[model samples]
Target: MGTIKDDASLVEQALLQDEESKRYTGDGSVDFKGRPVLKQNTGTWKACPFILGSECCERLAGYGIGINLVSYLTNKLHEGNVSAARTVSTWTGTYFITPLIGAVLADAYWGRYWTIAGFSIIYFIGMCILTLSASIPALRPVECLGSICPPATPTQYVVFFLGLYLIALGTGGIKACASPFGADQFDDTDSEERIKKGSFFNWFFFFVNTGALVSFTFIVWIQDNAGWGLGFGIPTLFMGLSIGCFFLGTPLYRFQKPGESPITRLCQVVIASVRKRDLVVPEDSSLLYETPNKSFVLEGSRKLEHSEELR
Candidate 1:
């Protein structure tokens, strides 16, 4: 492969390759490594379906959990009417905040794959807790360990809250990084592959929504009819499947090493600009211009005038 300089060179290389393959009719003047290039079979689009399937599964998992979450907290957990609102709010906040933590951890400590896997384990534990809470209602009296116990209190609410927080954290990590990670699979230097990458995001989201719709309609309905355990369990199952699917594509997936952010680069530029002696003015009355003409002078002119005054 030839070294790529810019977009124009990439496009030209693509067109030249196409011409050599007889996929396009043109004079084959372009040479690769001093030899007349012949057309090579680029192969069929195999990975597109896998990408779409993964996205669909992800959306389904998200939608299923989201649509049923509030009802699960209030109804299944049997949180009192007043406390239900606060409980739901807490759940929502944790879900949103975990992503920021996940992103930071992913960039600084865990690579994307490992971060996703670790969080997924935490998510599964949360699901198990939710299931246990729903199953064992009598455990509610043990709140805070050694606190006064109210007889016959339900523990479902406590379990549900803990579970929801875990799921939120896992979702935050996966949502922040997966798309960009997936996009890294395509080689952008190749024009044909680059065009395919542009279309990848569109299909990625489409499958996600499809999964969500299925999860919402089916998972919620199952929970309503069968039991809370089955309802929460359904999402757990799908999430597990989604994780497996992600790993299946691991061989084909491209991994990009994390690097410093643009903000860091910008701050460096600003610090360097500020540190130059010529860029900073001294805090002295003697250096101040005393005349009206000096007030309207440009920076270079002021410097020249100050030098002249010194002479």
Candidate 2:
């Protein structure tokens, strides 16, 4: 009986120690360092292939569209040099500026997944419209009517410009958000995974360039010989496939709610400071009585106090 009681106490003590150790284990809880490590094994690495695949496909489609866009606008669209230049400028400006908008939208409203998916649909629609405009001569009359009025005759060039603008809007959204979205997938808290995340950007760019190289070399030739419809159509097909591929890994992708950007936070701080400056203060306050003075021993402290009083 004595031996059995001693053994029971030993068992209880062991159980208590086990529970305490688990509670204190650095890996088991939600500390900043531990959270990331815990998430590392939660299927993030498996999702990387899909992200990389989407990146490659996006680059391919973009390059395919780019390599032939000038020629398509000038020659196939049948525009004068002046008209083509203006159209190109408009298209380029829209393409560049819309990305900033897309980034803001992605961060503030849409998560990366939704942003990519939504923009991809828009991209597909834009590609379809471009292909349709290039293929069907009859649709050109309606589409180009605005560009071709009494002052300016409707031209295939006008249709091309409209199509290019739509494509720009779509591509801008994707370009701005996709990479950052992909990076978001890796759990950065784990040291090994953090290293992998760092490596992902490099690999992402490499694959994108590879896709671009292929598209520029081959897709351009197909467009040059096969006709505009087929040229644009190929990219449209690839974009669709890319979208499908992205969706395939949706379950594996980790999402982060967009937060205020550093610039935005800085701007907010500045605005708040300005507003505070404009605030009315009670006349009798001790801060209102503070004065600036120069003294070597306490000059810095005095200056800070004076500044705070002014604020």
Write candidate 2's Cα lDDT for 70-171 as tens digits: 777656555677876776777777877888767777766765667788887887787777778778865443334545622223655455556667778887
Supply the TM-score for candidate 1. 0.64
What is the alpha-carbon lDDT of model 2 when measured against the actual structure?
0.69
Compared with the true structure, model 2 gives a TM-score of 0.70
TM-score against truth, every candidate = 0.64, 0.70
lDDT tens digits by residue: candidate 1, 144-186: 3354433334344455567767778778777777675555445
What lDDT would each prediction earn against the true structure? Answer: 0.59, 0.69
Compare the candidates by TM-score and give the number of the best one: 2
Q: How close to the true structure is residue 86 of candidate 2, measured as C-alpha lDDT?
A: 77
